[model samples]
Target: MDKNVLFQKFVAFTAAVHQTTNEITKNVKSETITPLHYKILEYIAVSQPVTLSEISECMHMSMPNTSRELRKLSEKQFLEKVADDEDRRKHIIRLSKKGEAMMNESFQRIESRFIERMEHVSEEELKEIERALDLLHSKVFN
Candidate 1:
């Protein structure tokens, strides 16, 4: 394939992903919590007491951006920073009660939206798409 064609295909793929995510998450009411914020919260909630670096790595976010998002969440009382027992200078992140509640609420909407959207596609098509997506994601991220 030509380079331009490849580039266009890449852009199209990314746009499709963004559109799908927006459709699902746009209805999820979250105050001052962007998808990135929810992503961080979900990660921390599931993997508690995780180091900031670990979260950053898992999210593929820069330290500065992750720290900024963490600051916002901390200010909102959704998450708390706890000093690392092994390293005092480093801090781990964990979701507070508020964060957990927010996560649960948002996740429900996300899951429901996904299911609703998937319902439109035939089972065979859905399975094929899932397999394709898995292959694509593995190639890109792994």
Candidate 2:
């Protein structure tokens, strides 16, 4: 399977993606939240109406710590905690309008940057990239 070659390619791919993305994402900052909090917000932006336990597990944080951090975001009006309609005992968390705007701001920059980067790529290669991404998502990342 050429596992080492595959691993090296993934490492290089991620390093390249992260190099630009990290800088573009840096613009989403606030005096009220730290980088960790920003990451939590960013994660929520992608996976909204998420639950506390899901965030905790995905963020690799303890339940208490996740709750505490979410409380801080909630206080700042960046997120909301609503009772789950399907499961009354559960609480679902979602980004407030402010948080959505914050993430969208960075998203525009990132999208523009990627578009510029892909300008040199041929349409056939772009199709190949799309297929590769789909395969990776379905088989490896899923």
* Local distance difference test, each candidate: 0.84, 0.87
List ranges where model 2 is wrong by over 4 Å: 11-20, 30-32
For residues 34-127, write the lDDT of model 2, one tens digit per residue: 9989889988988887999999999999999999999999998989999988889999999998888877876777787778879999999999
In model 1, the runs with Cα more than 4 Å from the true position are 1-4, 32-69
Write down the worst ten-residue block by lDDT for model 2: 23-32
Error of 1 at 89 (Å): 1.4
Q: What is the TM-score of each candidate against the true structure?
A: 0.70, 0.83
Global lDDT of model 2: 0.87
lDDT by residue for model 1 (1-142), tens: 6989988998998999878877777857586777778778877877898988898899998989888888988999999888878889999788888888888898898898888878879989988999998988798746
Could you say which candidate leads in TM-score?
2
- Candidate 1 lands at a TM-score of 0.70
